[model samples]
Structure formats: structure tokens, C-alpha cells
Target: MNMHIKVTTDDKDRALLAAIQDGLPLCERPFAEIGKVTNMSEEQVIARIEHMRQQGIISRFGLVLQHRPLGYRANAMVVWNVPDQEVDEAAKIITAHDFVTLCYCRARRAPVWQFNLYCMIHGQQRSIVEQQIETIKSAGLAPYPSKTLFSLRRFKQTGARFSTTPENERRLG
Candidate 1:
């Protein structure tokens, strides 16, 4: 939830941050366009981005896709209960499938919550997604215990953004 990267910036950095935060243009020469706006060369822009990431001024850089707009209507977060000894291996296997977009291991709140490994799957329809999951399950997706939590609605989907406020303008939660 902390969007602002804890790093100092100057006037020259304003245009650079603006250019990137707005998103790089979807083209072969994205850096060139950004450089034109920032008055920096393509190499300079790329270098600065790399420097920002290294300095923790930027955490990530990648495309932000809108899955719903792309015809993927059904989306589910599949949680699985894998044994503590095999969770790592199970996670690795789950992450290998094309349908599984995100897969990671989480803590097991035993006696109350037992699922540990989680993955996300998407498809054009709910049945398709379920079928895909069954295929994976038949291929030993969980092999332990699992459940699927389909998203009934979407509240929000977004990526990180740099703070524009001055040091004095930030409000505490």
C-alpha cells in the first residue's frame, strides 16, 4: 500500500517520473518517446529507470493488462493445502502451467485455515476455467487438499504510483 518509493528527487526528475508514471507508450521505441518528452536520450532514460530500481526509487516496471477487457471473464483464486514438506515443490509445479498466472506459498492457519499454496486462473467462461482447473487437478495440481474462490466482483485493480506531494503534504493513516 506504500506507493511512494523512499528516494529523493529533484526538478530534472519531475519529467522523468511523469513520463514513466503515465506509462511508457506501447511501441517499439518507447524509450525514445519518453526521452523526447524528458529531453533525455533513450539510453539515458533506460539508465535512469535502472538506477531508480536499484535505488529503490522504483520497485517494478512492466505492462499493466486489463484482463476483463481482454475477454477473460472468469477469474478465480485457487488455494491449495499442500503438506509443509512438499509445498515448495507443489508451488513450483503449479506455477509452471499457462493457466496459472500467479502462484505462491503462504502460511497455514492450522485447525482454522489449512490452505497454503495459492494460484490464479482466468478464462473466457467459468466452466472453461473450472475445466482447466480440473485438467490441472487430474494432472496433480493439488494432490493434497484445495478450494477455489471465484471473484464475484472487482473493486479495484491498479499498480504502484509515485507520490507527487511535497514532504509536508503527506497525511498519516
Candidate 2:
């Protein structure tokens, strides 16, 4: 069966979305800071976010890390060629490590690109990240063929954009 859900947003909801579309404030009470801007209580901000999530208006909330500024200069995307039957187990093992920041599966194009699972490791130095990868390989994943592609440059990373109207821009400004 195929089903599609449409999310409707009002002005108040737009205001809330505008406030958070960039990124939440970095502080003890981020929602309270947002509440101050939107003229809503902290409880109200929490309730609206929850309601929006339930209604499918907000799919997810994520964190974007500025790794380089925090001394994590060595970041590598490790790709693994795991068999189809063992992809899940391989992913679980990779994600269990503390240094493994991200892990997910992707489709492989045969005869060209064969990697099916990918994970990221971030560290202050290249040797540390390499050691972490070695640790991961020691943890029952040594049999899989893998490649580590170190990041050469950092890119601008931000959250999803929801509002572009002038009024929303003014509110954000």
C-alpha cells in the first residue's frame, strides 16, 4: 500500500520553524531562549515541537559538529565491502566503537563501486584515527575489505532550511 502524508503549517508554526531551522542555541536552556524570541513559554516551545514531530512537520533534529575548530583535524570516511547477508552485523560492530562517529549503509554499483557500508572516524591526529580504524578491524571486522578516505578540507554544514519568506527572514534576523 502507498500512502502520503501532508503536513500543514500555520503562522505560529512558521514562526517556530523559522526560529529553529538554522540550529538551536548552544546553552543550558535553548528552548527557553527560543521561547523568548517567539514570545512563547519554554513549555509551549517544547509542546509545539513535539506536536510538529507527531504531525510529520519535523522529521528529525540533528547536530552539526564543527570538527576542525574543536581539534579533530583528522576525519576519515571508512568504506567497507561487506557481503549482503552480513551487512547488518558489520554495521552494528562498526557503530559500537566510541570513535566511530557515523555509520550507515549504501547501495553498491557492481563492476565499479563495491562498498556497501560507510562510517566516519574523527580524531585530533591522523595516527589516532588510524589506530581507531585498526581497533575496529580487530573487533571481528578484519575479514571485510575496506578503504579509508581522509578528508582534505572541511565544508560548511548546516541544518535543513524550511522558511524563505521575507517575514520569516525578518523574524530570524
Candidate 3:
């Protein structure tokens, strides 16, 4: 019996992967266009994509859009004062919600801003996202008072790039 071999790659694989990373074309024959460059048939291009996904090399494939371009102008970083015991559970609930885009537990800072559960929400107006934060506050998960630090200005919003490379030191700007 001739079993199918698992998909593996060489120099060409890196090039094909780079093409996929760059962004797939949005046209009537997107695969055909990619095939022209990779020297693979349209079917091969599609098959490779499937193989990449199955191998866990690709987490997802879709358009990367700027929220502001889509009319979502405001971005807010809201925080909550969740009890130590319930913080993990509360975070799980918050992260699961569709409206809560970002959630993390930071060390409690005190009277000035004691909220530890942080979340970021983007919307058309400040009030809309603010109300969402209020809803979360009233949810009773946060036993302590909470505060939100809304973004006064948006300097930059960039898409993330996934890589397997390692560096001794890296910084975010």
C-alpha cells in the first residue's frame, strides 16, 4: 500500500509560506495567481494551505483591517478590581465575551487606580465603549470598584506578525 507522505518543505516551502504570510490575493482566481509565482497548480496551492492549517502552522486566514478605517474610532483601556480568588475566573468570563477584546490581570495599584482586570474596547464613540465597561462592572465579578483609562489619542495601530525566531532582548514601541 502506498500511503500519502506528510507535507514537508525546503527553500521553496519558505517562499510559499512567505507568499501566504504576505496576504492572499483577493480576486476571481486568487489561487491561480499564487500558483503562477510558486510554480504550483491552483489545486496545489489550495492543498498546501489545507496542509499548513492541519499542521498547525497557520492559526487563521482572513483580512487584517484597521478598526478605525471601519468607523471604530475610539479605543479604551478599562480596568476592574477583581478579588484575588476570583480574578482568574472573572478573566475567563470577560475574555469569553465578544465585546471584551482584550483582558489581563495586572498587579493592583491602589486608591488611584486599583483595577487589575484590564480590557480594551473599540467603538464609534467613547460613550459606547464606556457603557460596555459599566455593564462589566455591574456584572458583580469585580467585587471592588473599577476605573477605565480611555485612550486620549491613538498614535499607531499595527497588525501583528507571527514568528518563531528568538532574540535575547526585544522591546515594544
Candidate 4:
């Protein structure tokens, strides 16, 4: 059964959300640092975030690395046309590799896109990324048909934004 739960956010919750919308600061005590900006104690910040997560207000908290600046210039999305029944097992094998940064499955749009299982491989050089793909293929995905699409450009990536009003905007100095 599908159920919808409504969660209300107070002023403090808004402040906390604003403080972390750009991602947490890189510090020994990141929550403590956020506490300073939101005017809440470190424990309050952590507790509120946890409460928000349990309430389904915050679905995910993840890191977005700048691959280009990190020398990962060659990025490829390897798509595989694996049988539906085998997708989960194939994804498990693909995600086990340290080189594979992202792996997921999408529904195939028949007549055009036959591939469903997708994984990302990032490396400093194109050859290295290609070799990594070969290694992955040998690791058990050899029988499946696949294609590698190299990324030519990158667009800006950021976490979800909760508010856009001036009052909800809080930045750490």
C-alpha cells in the first residue's frame, strides 16, 4: 500500500535546510560548523537532520565530486542490454569495482534504446577507462551487448534546493 505522510518544517528546520543545501562543509566537525551558522547546537543539528530523514523530508544526502578537477577527465556511461532477470546480479558485479562510480537500471524504451543497465567509469585517460570496461566485461558481463558513451562535457550538479526565498537563505561565513 502507498501512504503519504506530511511533514511540517519550522523556522529552525528551514535554517538547518538552508545551511546544508550547498553540501556540508569539509571539517573535522561538519555538524558543529553548521550549528554555528544555524545558531543551533551541534547535537540539535544532527538530531533535526535525523528526524527529517525519518519523517521523509530528506530523502538522500550525497556527495557530488568534481571529477574534472580531480583528473578524472575520461568519463563514460556503459549501458548494457542485459536480460531483465539478470539485471540485479549484473549490477552487483558492476558496482563491486572501485572504478565504477555509478550503477543503476532503467526501463528500456523499445525500438530505440534497448539498454537498461548502466554504469559509469571515470579515469584520468580514455584508454584507462576503456581498459576498465574490458576488465568489467571479463568479470562476467561478457555475454551481454553493451555500448560505451564518452562524456564530452559536464554540466553543473548540485543537491536538492528546499527554499528560494531571501529569509530561508543562510550561508556560512
Candidate 5:
């Protein structure tokens, strides 16, 4: 999709993106702290973030949960081979399930790979996650082909960085 998120020339925009690259502060008002650095009000920080999200510049913005620390062990990614016409409905159904943590509608690869809709199911045990998948499969998913991918190990987990290097003007890193 050709999304046009106006590239602000103001250094404050760069500063704001850079400051929040690591994370938003865990406090009463994190944006206020960001405002202090960017010389923007808390409202301004929130507005800019919302604008970015609206423009699809940032796919998602939120806290990064450390599932293991919170006693969540089974991290399974379930992908469903839903027809493009029905993928949206399938995503809605998948996300409605309490056990489904994250849901996305991605592009479908041809003949070799067909599944597009995906959701993550997290649980304390593999069996629990599997059970949840079974429940999800019954919810308008009996017709669709699906599979669960269990993560053997997390290779990397990092936040997206918006680079403002001179060479790149419109692209985000």
C-alpha cells in the first residue's frame, strides 16, 4: 500500500521517534517525559504517535511483554489458510477468542504457501495452548486449513527503530 505519512522536517519529530524507540516510560504520563525532551506537550506526543499509526508508518505501538517472566511458556503461532475474501472475517473470529493474543492478516504466498491469517496463542503449558487452538479451530474454522508453529527458541526480540539518516528521507528503518 502506498501510504503517505508526511515526512516532517522538524528535528523534534526525529527526536520524538528516537526517544521512544527503546520504550515509553512506565509512569503516570510517559508522553509528558517525552514532551520535556522534544519540547512537545504530552498531547502532542500522543497526537504524533496516533498520526503515525493512522498513516501505517508504524504497524503497531504498545508495551513489549516479557511472557516468560509472567509465567507464559507456550508461545505458539497459528496460521490459517483462509481465502482472501474470507480472511478478514477469519481474523475477527480468531481475535475474538480470549486465548488468541495477537492476530494479523498477511499476504498469501502462491502454491507452496497459502496461509495468510495468523494469531499467537500463549499459555503456561503446551497442552493448554493446544487446547485453545482446538477451541479456535471449532469457531468457524473447520473449513480452513491451519497449523500451529511452536517456537523452539526466541532468536531475537527488538523494537522497531525509525532512522533519520541523511540517505533515507521517507523510509523508516
Candidate 6:
């Protein structure tokens, strides 16, 4: 059986991680640029990131492209009332799909919201998102009713800043 491993790092490692959390730069030699500021060579930086990933300090790295800027703006949270035993299987199928960016299972409250499996899908138009939902339903998932909730306004979006020390005690290096 597989087991989890915990990562313990110093303040320097925390700072290095913080520098990378914003997403990698788009320019060529991005690691070199980052290395200059972090006092690490490009190869060292790359190797550290790889080590962190291997040790489970970081789940994964990704780029967050602005879909709206790319002209693919329509987005919605699609939820389904998946069977308890099949929730994991259904989530795998949903997340494995190219149209899905986010997929997970959440607690369900019947009558109000029976949806247990949720996925976020984005497309160029609302019709396309709806069509994807139709395909998902037609894939023999009609037994579990689904609902589409489109985002109206993005009020606030934030991420956690992990630190080796408590917030009040941390000082700039």
C-alpha cells in the first residue's frame, strides 16, 4: 500500500516556493531569470522544483491562461447527482475529459442540491457549455440529475501563502 510523505523545509525553501507559486514566466530562459533573484542557478531551480514535486511538497504546476482574453469566456459549474459508489469513477471520466478544467466530489444536500460530483467547463459560448452537458448526460448519466451554475461576478480570488513561520512572525529576508 502507498503512504503519504511529509515535507519539512527552511525559510529559504518557503521563499523559493512563494516565487514559483505565481506561475512560471512566459519568456524564454524563465528559470534563469527567476534563478537570478532567488540566488540559484537555472539547473538548481529546475531540480528543486522537481524535487519538491517528487516529495509531494507541491501537487503540480500549471499556467492559468485567461480564457476570456482568448475569446473562450463562457464558463459554468456543472454538478451531478452521482451514485455514492460511482462518484470516483464518474469524477475520473469528467476530469479526464478535455472540456473539464476542474472536477471533484462534494457533500450533497437533497432537495436543495443533490449534486455530488461537480466539474467546471469553459467554452466560447453558453451553447457549447450546454452541449457538453448534454453529452455528459447522454453518456448514461441521466439517472443523476444535473444543474449548471454560471458565474456572474468574480468578487475575489486568492491563494494560500505557505510559510515556515507564522504570519505575524515572518520577516523579509
The lDDT for every candidate, in the order shown, is: 0.78, 0.85, 0.70, 0.86, 0.80, 0.76
Q: Kindly list the per-residue Cα lDDT of model 2 for residues 119-145, writing each as its tens digit.
A: 999899999899999999999789999
lDDT of 4 by residue, 84-137 (tens): 999888988898899998898888998899999999988999998999999999
Off by over 4 Å in 4: 1-15, 25-41, 50-64, 164-173
Among these predicted structures, which one has the highest lDDT? Answer: 4
List the lowest-lDDT window of 10 residues for candidate 2: 1-10
Candidate 6 — what's its lDDT?
A: 0.76
* Structural similarity to truth (TM-score) of each candidate: 0.67, 0.69, 0.61, 0.70, 0.73, 0.72
Q: Which residue pairs collide in model 3, if any? A: none
Per-residue lDDT over 12-128 for candidate 3, one digit per residue giving the tens place of the 0 to 100 score: 445566556667788899988988987889998888888777765555667777777788878888777777888777877677668877777788767666777788888888888
Cα lDDT tens digits, model 6, 66-125, are 667687778899988888999877776676668888887789886787889888998889
* lDDT, residue 3, model 5: 35
Candidate 1 stretches with Cα past 4 Å from truth are 1-19, 25-42, 50-62, 110-112, 164-173
lDDT by residue (62-155, candidate 1, tens digit) is: 8778899898879999998887898777776776688888887778897999999888998889998998788778777646788999988889
Winning model by TM-score: 5
- Select the stronger candidate by TM-score from 5 and 6: 5
Clashes by residue pair, model 1? none
* Cα lDDT, model 3, residue 108: 73
Candidate 6 global TM-score: 0.72
Q: Worst lDDT window (10 residues) for model 4? A: 164-173
Question: Which segments of model 3 are wrong by more than 4 Å?
Answer: 1-17, 38-40, 52-59, 80-85, 104-117, 144-147, 162-173
Give, for candidate 6, the lowest lDDT window spanning 10 residues. 164-173
Return the clash pairs for model 4, or none: none
